[model samples]
Target: MADSSCGPRPLPPDDLALLSGLQPHDVRKVAESKIQAYRAMIEDINGYIIQLSTIQNTTVPLHASLPPEILMHVFRHILPTGPSDLRLTHVCKLWRDLIFRTPEFWVDMLAISAVTAHLDHNTDSPLSFPSFVVRSSPLPFELDLHRGALDFLRTIPSHVSRIHSLSLHLPLGSDYAAYLTALFNLDMPLLETMRCSTYATAWPIGLTDSTTHRVPDGQKFPRLRKLAFCGPGLPTRAFAFPSLRELKFDDGMFSEPLGPLMDFLESCAQLEVLEMNIQSPARQFRTERDAVSLPHLKIFSLLLDAPEGLWAYDFLEQVIVPATAQMNITWLAGSDHPLRYLIPTSPLSLSVEAIQVIHTLTIRFNYDRTVRDDSKWILSVNGFVPSHSQPYLKLTIHCPCWTLEEDVRPSDALSDLSGLFTCAPSLQKVKLRLDHGITVTPDHWFVILNSFPSLSSLTVRIGSCRSLLTVLRRNPTRWPALRRLSISCRNGSGVHECLLSAIERRAREGSRLEYIAFSGSPRRRLSEHRMRRLEGLVDEVTTVNEVEFCGMH
Candidate 1:
């Protein structure tokens, strides 16, 4: 009989006949032969695997030719804790092994929330927080958590000391006191940088919330060098950062009493860079304390939006910096208050002796009465030391104008412009750009021009060139020290005639220009005919292309 294990299917006619004629011994022998063939096939497969393994071990791939250290160094250029790093581990078996062994590749541990996934496009399955911490071993690593920051910190209490940098991004409308308390309670001895930000509408813990959850006393980050707080938060109080050198606060308004803010600044005595953008409240009650002294501060930037009044000036009176420090102050105030109020005729916060000898001054005045909004007027002043590539001081003031007057009085414009240059007595180079919306008579321009008696070089832009030419034609002896003149215009149609007339008139008066250059758009370039005319009146004449002229500005 056929084996019952073969199931109910009937065998082929010839196979059935052969099986009937064969004895039991013949069937057993056939089965033994089939078993031997299967063994031989398994052996062949095993040998093939061994041969392939031997080849892989003996032959080196192109990437494997380099030393493991060099390859790891190249991988460092790729992003640390993202899909890019995950791809490196899957390139080949050799690379996979090397990436797993190298601890530097796993030094940045990140946990991202769905809302902030755009900040870190990491969706790899292998990046568990604990796995990263263990894989990174004893080396210092950075921790970036976009959400669930407080809970994550709870699970890794022991690993806080190894954190090199920590960044936390909190959701909008969430209470920030818990986050701050969690941060203050921890001890981060090796931490070098810490950044905490939120999307809250206002500071989470304001003056009203000061009574709740006070920052623990005697807490400090000893090695912290950089601290940044964005969005809004409670006042910094009762914390010490002896080595902190840089601090930044953006989009925050200090609560009514400025005492807490002052106390926080007093702790960071060695700060080198301090930047803040806060809104100042109206009622200016002078904080009854000595100015916070930041002698080591090299870059100080303060931006304020005070609609009720010019509280920025009053606030700045409490802070003192070095005379050589660079300052950039921007204030947005009501139209009734002039820039002269914010930047007084006498130096308010800046040292008088340091600003008295500035060499280069750039004045950019833009105003449009037609648009009755807060951005209708902006006055920008930049001062530079002759040898320095960076400006030592920059002051910009914005005001809202409700008036629709097409023309303003000449004296009104002169008063505002003259009061600005009182501190720049030693200025030798001036770049003046005025918007077309502002209208002024030639006499006003002449008065403004004569204020810089020591100015030897002048650059005029746009419609301001017409007023300058009129001033030069009206009074050839206006700016006696002016020798070099550069004029840039949007259109050069009737500008050539004005330039020729002014230069010829100035030459006839014996105060000949030493050099003159005219630049405009490609389609509006001065004709060669007019270029020759200007060349005769001045010692040297040049026409600058549009691309080159924009850089000069």
Candidate 2:
């Protein structure tokens, strides 16, 4: 009755009875499974925590370790004047603050704008003006200002006091007078170095008169050490630099007397190095009436125009040699005269030790189209015997000219070289500049190489690839002690192939070839496979030392 009273209710199984049937050991096993699962999960989480802890302890604290001073120094080294450099400061507030605070960093300035439009429009007038002025403050150091930015230059005088070094590239047709006036007004007391390059064609009318005004006595750069000037129509007005040690002038268009030039140099009695390139064709420079003395003149270079009949022998014998007895003269004879004219016929009578003391002698033959015959001039320095008592003479010749058809044979030039080697037993190195179209035969090079057993280096310049390969294939044995052998030819016409072949031959012969340089048209490209093959045969291949293509043709 109870069961049927409510509509057939289902009966619940007795849970206590079911529990009683389970063994205690089985219950423990079920509990142990649950515990193991919990432990595994806890271990997994702990492992993750340990790994994070290790990373936190070992990782670098970059921001904390970097000092502000180090960052500032790095920024100073990298931040120079330019659109790119200026933008770096805007990357962060720290950079902007650091850059703006350091005034010394902005002192050394470079004004390289060639057009007034960009500088006048983009530059901050007050900031740019003060930055340049600060460099010339306290004491001037160095300032390099490009031409065409005349608008900006007007501000230079305001900051001229801090300038110690000044390099100006004045444009043609600019207001040079105004620029000079501003420059002369500066009180550059500590100025040491000055270089000026003027475009003669650009000067406005009456610019020379304004530029020639005497640099005021009080404003003179008494501490100046080096000075260089280049332009046409330089003033003959004399100036002085008592502390000057070096002076260079590239006045290729000077038609005035050497008096003013010499007078300026004479004021710098302590000058140790002097380089003058007066392009006047007249060799009528009158020697100093008084006893000329440049006791400290250790280095001297002259680029003077040689008179038609007058060789440099008289100048060297009477003036240069005696004045520069202790000097190491590097004469760049850029004239059409023969090399023999420069040397004294009395070298035999001169002391060998005195001649051997010559540290460097460079003879750059003139390549003017006006002079028709441009062959290899024979230079004989005979009489100095190569013995244990005397070492070989060191001579370097630079000939940048095409070989005339008559001077095509290397033997003809080699004969003169042989004679030169015979005369100067101390001839250690011979640098020949051959015509690009002319080929130097190996047989001819052999004769010259045979003459100098003591020759340590040989630099043969071939104008054509065919000729260089011809020489290398023929005379591999002539350069026995040749530590350096350089072959430079026109880049086109398979010249690199010739070089590789020569390198391979040298490798087979167990010869040591140190350096190989190539010069030619830019259109020529040496294949990578060919270069790798060449590298296997030699130590190095350098394409950077390019031969200059210079000719009227």
Candidate 3:
């Protein structure tokens, strides 16, 4: 291609070739001189063109032309992880100046990429995390401190008033007990969300729920909303979290009674989301305590290392939650009895005693941002209310990436679940996952879908698109109430085109698939051309990733 930016071609001033043709020697010599002059001019033009190109290449846009605040907002989105924000300064001197001058960016948030940089043994020229904290002066702080970053303990006394969100990872052998004792003593008026994890070999990892480790008596966390205590520590008592909305206690073995746990729950009046993974001793929360009612609780999930579901039943029975609230209970693989119980007919119609027995098993699917997260799940509905609502009674089994042992099938246990369908007359909306390595076949899924006459919606995960399409094609009366057909597939599997043809054929036959949602890995999703064609075939077609959230958080 021609360089359009280059100036127009330079021309010789005189036509010396014609004079050379008329007079042989003298005119030819004069033509040669004219050619030499033209060559020199051409060289100059080439050099000038190179100079122009250099100028164009050197010109840079630091996004300074756009509003700085808007650009900063974009940068924040680029790396929500926060500490990675400092990398922006290395882009250019302008960006460096802008980032350094922006106190808001530095003040409330500081992420030192490596914690041990300041240690004498780690580096001679240490990268000071405190320097960033200092620059972020007069602004509320959000810190991400990892293991070996205990130097942050030194800065906390001075900046205690400014700390807003703090995530600390205390090393196992270190004296974190004292460090935390000093930490909770400080006045943190602006602190809201705090997560503390430690490797110490104590009953509680970092700060226990005990008042001994809590902030000074007068200092309370009025604005504190979220607390994720993710180590061995269990909050002993209510530590005054007035505004606590979400509390996550993950991976801990509490060696205390249920009284303090109940008290902590009672303290958070505004608590909406609670996730805990604590292992109860053999005794469990069976101390004959009074029921604690949670009015505002929307999502309650428990990940336990307990032996049986009865432990959960005992605890959940005491804590009264709304009927609509979603509860997810997961425990260490012990007895499969809880997940395998057979409800007589309608769970809603069952006696209270029978319901208590059923409650031993977990209830409700874990509501995730996206279904693509790679968590192994065994979903079963105990029974259903006879409401016209879509989600009533139908068992939802999401086995995205099931664990296999010694060449064992993904879920032989689920195969035995075919008996449960005999009791599900009101069941509707069956969504099943199948992909790269699952043992469940399309034929098995087809049989299940065919069994339910009341099945209104059908969703299938297609690792190999042809098999499921073949299944749908084989059964003419697959689902009478089937209005929605959702396909979860890997992108480049050529599934979209096959899906369009199959669903279109179904539409022609009268069971018009009202909605078709196609979801898969982003890289393998259908190209725009295929997506447009698929859209035309169905009334509504949605493209999505299969294990969406399973990948991100």
Q: Which candidate is the best by TM-score?
A: 1
Count of backbone collisions within predicted model 2 = 23
Q: Count the backbone clashes (under 3 Å) in each candidate.
A: 0, 23, 14
Q: lDDT by residue for model 1 over 1-553, one digit each (tens)?
A: 7788978866467555555656799977765776697699999999998678655843676554777778777765555544454676666666766776666666642432332233322333345565565566677877777677767766767777788788887544444555566666788777888787766445433433334534344344678888787765423653336677888877455444555556667776888998877764542433677878888988988777665334555555667666567878776654345435554336544433335656888877777667764366776778887778788778776652322343334235434555556666778888877665455566667767776778789886655367768888878876778889887776555667888888888889988999887776567677788778778888998888645755674
Residue 553 alpha-carbon offset, candidate 2, angstroms: 41
Give one digit per residue, the lDDT tens place, for model 3 in 501-534: 6776777778777787766657666788877776
Worst 10 residues of 1 by lDDT: 112-121
Off by over 4 Å in 3: 1-98, 104-109, 112-126, 146-158, 169-182, 202-219, 238-240, 253-259, 279-283, 305-307, 331-379, 382-553
The list of candidate 2 runs beyond 4 A from truth reads 1-70, 79-81, 108-127, 131-141, 146-158, 169-185, 201-219, 233-237, 278-283, 287-291, 303-335, 343-553
CA shift at 151, candidate 2, in angstroms?
9.9
Model 2 TM-score, 2 decimals:
0.48
lDDT of each: 0.66, 0.50, 0.55
Residue pairs with backbone overlap in model 1: none
Q: Judged by lDDT, which candidate is best?
A: 1
Measure candidate 3: CA RMSD. Answer: 20.5
For candidate 1, give the lDDT.
Answer: 0.66
